[model samples]
Target: MSSPPLPLPHLALIGAGITSLTLSLRLTSLGIPHTIYEQSPSLTELGAGLGFGPNAARALEYIDPRLVEIFNQTATFVGTPSPQGKELLLQEGKAGDDKIWIEFLDGTKQPEEGEELKPEFVIRAGNNKGHAAVHRGAWLDVLGGLVDTRERVRFGKRVVDVVLPAGSKGRVKILLADGTEAEADGVVGCDGVKSKVRQVLMEALGEGREKGKCGYSGKYAYRCLVPWGKAVEAVGEDRAGVSSLWMGPNRHLLTFPVDKQDEKFLNLVAFVTDESQVWPERGPASLTLPATKADALGDFEQAGFSDSVLQLLKVTNEKMDKWGLYDVADRPLSKFYSGRIMVIGDAAHASTPHHGSGAGFCMEDIAVLGALFEEAIARQRLTVDALEDVFAAFDNQRRERDQWLVNSSRRAADLYQWRIPEFLKPNSLEKMKADIEQRQEFCWGFNVGAAVREAKKHMSERLAAYK
Candidate 1:
C-alpha cells in the first residue's frame, strides 16, 4: 500500500533569539522551508550567562546530540559543594530518595550529614551543582551558527501586524516595520516577552483585558559581566566553579562562572524588591559610601558577598542592566493559536527566572513545533485547516506545562527570598529538596517527540471533519 504524500507548509518564524534558532534548526532537519524575521538590526549577545538544567539539556539533545556534547565539554556543571560553606537547604529527587547535600555559610546543617535524607528533599547547597552554567552569547552563537544561510534569517524586520487573508483558509501575511510584507502558510510567534503577534492572537479571541494586562512581580534585577582574570584574583581560583548565593533581608546576590578559561568571565545577578513594574530601566552605577573601600561596598559588602561580586560592581564603568521581573499571574490562556498564526516561548507564557528555565521552556517550544510540523507534512495533512488543528493541539499539550512553570518559578522566588522565618528555616532544606524532585518529574520528564505524536493523533481526527 502506497502512502499519501505530505503537505508542504511555507513557515514564517519571527525573532532570531535562542528559541527561534532552535526551531530554525529543527525545521531545516525536516526539510520544511522557513523564513525568520528578527527585530534587532544586528544580532548580538544580550545577557551574560544562563543556567540550564537536565530538562533543557534534554530538549537540546533532541535537537542535536552534538549540541549536548559541546555544552558538556565547554560548560561547567556544579553538582557537589566544597567543604568551604555550611549546609542550610536540602532538595530531594522525585522518588524522595536521592538528596542534594550542601553546607551553608554559617556551617549549620538543617539536616546534618549521615542523617536519613529523603530523595524528595533538596539540600539547597546540593542542588546548586545540578545545573550547567554557560555564557549567554556563547550559547546563542552556537545555535545561530547552525542555522542555514539559505533559510535567510532576515534582520531589521520588526513585525508590526499580522494580516490574515480575506477568507479563513488564506495565506498568512506578515506586515514589517519597513512597510514591506511577506506571506506564508503559517506564522510562529517566538517574538519574546513583549510580543506583537500575541496582541493579534488575543484580539482574535475577543480577550481585550488579557491582551492589555501585564504582570508586575514586585522584583527587579541588576546584572553585570566581569572578566575571569579579575574575578579569580579577587575571589580566588578555588571559588571559580562554585556559585555563591548570599541571602539577606528582602534581597539576594548570585555569582557564577560562564566560561571554562582559567581567567574566565563571571556573571553576577542581584535581585531586589522594587515596587515599580517598568521594563528597560537602568540601575544606579554607584551607591553612597564612606571613605573606606568596605564602606563603598555598602549593603553588598555587609552581606558577605564574594570579592568577585564587589570587584565587578566597582569596575563596572556603565550602569548595570536593570529590568523588572514580570510573569503572567493570570491563569494560562486557553488558546495559543488562531487562523495561521500561533504564539510560542515567552510570548505565550512569560515566567520568572527563579528556576533558570526561561530558555529551557523556549527550547521545549521549538522541539514540539518541529515534531508537529514533521508529522503533519509526513501524513500529507499540512493545510490551512490542518495547521489550525495542529496549532490547537500544540497549545492544548503545552499551555498547562507552561503555566505550571510560571507558577513554579513564582514559588521558587518566594522560597529563595531573604526573609524566611526562623521556624521555617529548619524545614526549608527538606522542603526545597522535595520541590526539586517534584519539578524534575514535571519538567525534566517532558518528551517533545511524544507530545508531537499525541498532537498528530488529535489533529488527524480534526482534519477528517473537513474532508
Candidate 2:
C-alpha cells in the first residue's frame, strides 16, 4: 500500500546547532522539507570536547550512517575505542562511581581542620577506556558536513517567540527578533539551552511564561587544551593518552586526548565547586567568557588542589573558556510540546555535563521524532491533528528518561563529591567500580534501535485516533 502524504510540504526548524543539523538529516532523508532558522550569524559550536556512547552513536548512525563514519574519522579522539560505539559520558560524578584514575591530593581529610595538608590514600585507576571524546567544534563540523543541511539552513534569524498563528488553524508562527515573522505547518525546535521556543511551549501549557526557565547548576567549568607533545611530556607517554582524573576535597580535574588533528591536543576541564564562588555573570544571561590560565590556577589554589594535577594543568594550551553551567531541572516542566510546536535537544531538556549525555539524549530525541515523521510522511497521515499525536508520542516516550538525565546529572555531582548519603569505605576500589557500573548502565546500555521501534509502535496507535 502507498503511504500517506505529509500534510504540509514545508516545515520550520528553529536554531541550527547540533540538534537542528542532526534533525535536518532525517527530514531531508524522508524528503520532508524544512528550513532551519538560527539566531547565530553562522552555524558553529563553541565549547570543549564531548563524548558519545553506544546509544547516541547508534542514534547518529540511524540519523545517517555516514555521520558516524565522519565522526569516527574526524571527531573520535581520546577515550576508549569501542568495537561498536563509544563517547564521553560525564565530567565526573558519584561518590563511589568514578571512571578515571582518582588521586587524593593534599589533606584528603575534611577541610574544617587546621591539619597539615598531605596525601592520605589513592585508588589506582586509569585503565578504563570506554568512550569517544571529540572537540565540540570539530564534532559539530563533522555532523554539519555529513547531514548536508547547510543549503536549507538560514542563519541570523533570531527567534523571539513561537506561538500558534492567528487564523491559521493549527499552524505555528515564529516571531523573529527583527519584528518579521514566518509561519509553517508545524515547528520543530532544535533550539538550545536558553530556547525561546521552550518558553512558548510552556506558555501554551499554561505553566506561566517563566515556569521552567533554565538556571545555573552551581557549577562553572574552566576548559582548555594541551598540545599533545607537551601533555605527553608532563603526564608521560602512556598516561597522557587515557582518561586521567585528579580528585580533591571539593574540586577535580579531568584529562583526555583529542585524536583529531583539528584539536590534536589534550582536552581537560578543571571544575571548581566552592560554595563561595559566585558567577561573575550574575544576570539571566549565561556566559562562556574567556578565562585566563592565571584565573584557572587561582581556582586550583582556592580549592586547595594538589600539585600532581597541577602538572597536567600547567602544560595546557594558552586558551581557556569558562562558563556557568545550567540545567532544566531548576525550572521543571510538565510536558514537551504544545499545539504545532515541539521542543527537542537542549530546547526541551538541558542537563548538566556531569552526565555527558545531553547531546546524546538530543540524538535520541531526533531518532524518535524523525522515525515518527518518517512514518507520518510514509503513511500520508501528516496533518495538524496527526502532528499533535506525534508530539504527544514524543513527549510520552522521552520525558521520563530525559528528565531523569537532569536529576541524575545533579545526583552524580553529589556522588562524585561524596556528599551523598552513602559512604565510601577505606580504599573502596571494588565498591567504586560497582557503584560506577550500576549508575552507568542507563547511559551505556540504552538501545536506540529499541527506543525507535517502541516509539513507532506507540505512535501507530496514536495515529489511528486521528484517522
Error of 1 at 318 (Å): 5.6
Q: Candidate 1 residues 1-467, lDDT tens each?
A: 97666556788988887787888888778777789999887566665888775567666766766676677666655542322211111112222222232212221112344442122222432332245677788777788777774356899899988877778777899999899999999999888766777777887777853552346677766776767676666556645445655444455666777773443677777766653434443332122111322332564665555444465457443455455676675535558888788889887888878767788888777667766766677667776667777788788778888878888877665655544464256556666556645664565456555665676676666666657
Model 2: per-residue lDDT, tens digit, 420-451? 54545566545655565555567655777778
Candidate 1, run of 10 with poorest lDDT: 83-92
TM-score on alpha carbons, each prediction: 0.79, 0.86
Predicted structure 1: lDDT: 0.64
At residue 158, what lDDT does model 2 achieve?
A: 90
Local distance difference test scores for all models: 0.64, 0.70
Q: Cα-based RMSD of the predictions, in order? A: 6.9, 5.5
Candidate 1 RMSD computed on C-alpha atoms after optimal superposition onto the true structure = 6.9
Best by lDDT: 2
Which candidate's TM-score is highest?
Answer: 2
What is candidate 2's TM-score against the reference? 0.86
